[model samples]
Target: MLAAAVAFLFLMQSAPAALRSATAEPRVVTPRGDLAADERATIELFRNARDSVVFITTRQRVADFWTRNVYTVPRGGGSGFVWDEAGHIVTNFHVIEGASEATIQLADGRQASARLVGVSPQHDLAVLRIGGAGFAIPRRVPIGTSRDLQVGQNVFAIGNPFGLDWTLTKGIVSALDRSLPNESGPDIRHLIQTDAAINPGNSGGPLLDSAGRLIGVNTAIYSPSGASAGIGFAVPVDTVMRVVPQLIATGRYARPALGIDSDDEINDSLKRTFGVDGVFVLRVEPGSGAERAGLKAAARTVRGVVPGDVVVALAGKPVSRFGDLQARLDDYRIGEAVELTLLRAGERRKITVALGAGTE
Candidate 1:
């Protein structure tokens, strides 16, 4: 009993010490005077860019069958940035697609009704205008050219991802000249690939450089889970600068057109059969630039369709496929004249065609 009592007392005495050591307070270090230079720069960049970024919400009109009443239903939400001091907002075309109405929410929580100004489905870009007595235009982002952008350079993306407003993500430019497919037209070329965490709601936000200049517009991401997987593509600002002005002025982007239709599958099959290496012109629209330039289209005969003028090159650039021709045309203006090298029958012919505006 004496030994048991002594042991119990010894255990009781050591328990408090063990508890004190286990629950000891962690050492707190005093914070420095301010953030580091790079940290300060990043914070300032976000502060300046946030005001330019806006949240976009859209709605669709739905009619009830029983009551015959029309109601507005919430469609979706995305992000955009101010294009200019005139209250022009730029966003992805897919965001406003099929939306009957849209609203723009500024960083200050001010909301206004937005009207669709124009859309370029080929580039997946759209412009919206907000104007009223209470509508106050936010600061516009400083535009930067993507032509001089270097891979691995630091970039910042400010957007509303998953409805989270004004979220900023930092990353580096992963690549340049990346291409993404467009549903309405040819591929969107010269995309800026980055590691920025761009999500669905970030579709139309500006991708800024280290200097807080708009370098690109965040568009899509390559992810299996429908979230950011470190691979995001942005439409380069050079293309944006070229298209937005035209859109704002004319309410549409007039792509230089050849007015010829070529089936890719058929063209590929014909190329393989003939052992040729050019885009086969399947059909030419009457009164088109192609038709006026004396370009002939493939004709259906007794055995099979006979191949017509195969587009070999454009403006001294070799066109291996239909997309190549479209991409080449993107570089030229609608009224510009281009030389098309064609392979017809057994000879190569050069023809000049003044480009015409393409219809969406």
Candidate 2:
């Protein structure tokens, strides 16, 4: 056995040099600081997407301690981006709200005066126009389809959080179709939630995908101390696309409406009295589609409480909440007709109501 082992060791020592070289090639390793494919993709996306980001500044006059009118120092600042070559810049309504003047700070550090082109306080989005030379508008991000967004899919956000301009953050889709409040009282719907770090100045910035397409507009963050707490919300690009074009053309988003105000507040007593789920008919506008369709409202007479027609559906769609009605109605253009399902006099009836221009 000893003689056989010695012969085997001698043979191993005499192995071919080409065999050893081939084995060493298999151990050829990359450098330690090399980035993974995903990390490379992220860096590339940020580089490509940062150019579209912009900084917003607004100025307003305020009375000093002397109560004299003076030029107030610039205070309001946020993030926005170019929406088109027409000089329409999209940002949060809160960013430049109550400002006398506005400016757009381009990624190249050139500041240009901008005008409030249009605003939709209901959706918390605003459009500004910078009509001058020497200000090269960045590429407007093409709107991507957000309806197919899946959880765990990567997303990127570029904003000027905490006055830090063009800060890029990446994360996965945390949630979707969330509901958040706006100036119109929670009328904004179809929000996109992300765990990405969205800070104060991040509002009105773009939320991009791996392909760097605009998927949403960073709007709000859920935080106890006004800083990012791992939860953030963005206005879906679909909604922004639907409103921005109209805003560019007319400086306002003209959505269709039923021209009637329904009782949005639902109490136990009201629900029990109406024998329906948390909805009541408070009033119907005269000469409106609701009135033309013979829709009645609850009356307060000397007798017991009377219930009017209960709207269970609109346009063959169930409306369990007031915001649902608003969300559905927002999809329709002005002057479009819609059908409504009403329960009146213990009988269900369907009526077609032509939508009118929204007063908003």
Tell me the TM-score of each prediction against the true structure: 0.89, 0.82
- In model 1, how large is the Cα lDDT of residue 275? 88
- The sequence of per-residue lDDT tens digits that candidate 1 reaches over residues 147-214 is 99999999999999999889999999999999876545677888999998999899999999999999
| Best by the TM-score measure | 1
Compute the lDDT for candidate 1. 0.90
In order, what lDDT does every prediction score? 0.90, 0.82
| Tens-digit per-residue lDDT, 1-360, candidate 2 | 999999999988898976565443456786788889989988988887787889998888777768676776786888998888878899988898899898788887788888888888778889998856755677777678788999898899999998988999988899888886443533778899999999999999999999989999999999999999999999999888888888888888776777666645542366676567624566788887778777788777888668787777887777655555766788777778888887787788888888877755
| TM-score for candidate 1, residues paired by index | 0.89
Stretches of model 1 off by over 4 angstroms after superposition = 1-26, 65-68, 272-275
